[model samples]
Target: MSAIFNFQSLLIVILLLTCSCAYIQSLAPSLLDRNKIGLLGIFWKCAGIGE
Candidate 1:
């Protein structure tokens, strides 16, 4: 039961992320362009979500 629930939850997350990325990319493409920050800026990257 736990395994099945986990699989279903993961699938839902995958679908949501797919839709979110597509919508975000089309709406404001600049928001996703954080690669320039490099590995050291991962903390700040996550903080951006709050904004």
Candidate 2:
């Protein structure tokens, strides 16, 4: 009985981790692009592109 309980808890933890990872993975690209754009903006200003 204790073994079965442990297995169930382990399964639940794995499922939660997998879901969270997937959620982060989905958001990662947008987060990365935002960072990239921020860097690009700094470079653009340094280069005086709009001036």
Candidate 3:
């Protein structure tokens, strides 16, 4: 009984991780663009490149 319960818990954790990863993966493109803009903004400010 304990073993079965443990197995079910592990399965639930795995499923949750998989689903969350997929959701994040779908957002990867937008996230990357946002990060790129953020980095560029930082560089422009630090180096006065944009000004």
Candidate 4:
């Protein structure tokens, strides 16, 4: 049980890091307004509206 819990915790941490990295990557100013668009895209995806 403890091992399973530890694995879940690690997975959660990894997921959080991945999402944060995606968000940060989408914040690039030189992307020519792509960041804001990507932000909306992320929201839609999270909401299951897209993809």
| 1-51 per-residue lDDT for model 3 (tens digits) | 453479887777656655654455455535423443564444323222212
Please write out the lDDT profile of model 1 over residues 1-51, one tens digit for every residue. 453479887777656656666566567756666543877344334434434
Residues 1-51, candidate 4: write the lDDT tens digits: 453469887777656655664565566424323434655555434322211
1-51 in candidate 2: lDDT tens per residue? 553479887777656655654454455535333433564444333223212
Score each candidate by Cα lDDT: 0.56, 0.47, 0.47, 0.49
- In Å, residue 42's CA in model 3 sits off its true spot by 30
Task: Choose the strongest candidate by lDDT.
Answer: 1
TM-score attained by model 1: 0.51
Cα lDDT, model 4, residue 1: 48
Error of 4 at 20 (Å): 0.2
* The 10-residue segment with the lowest total lDDT in model 1: 42-51
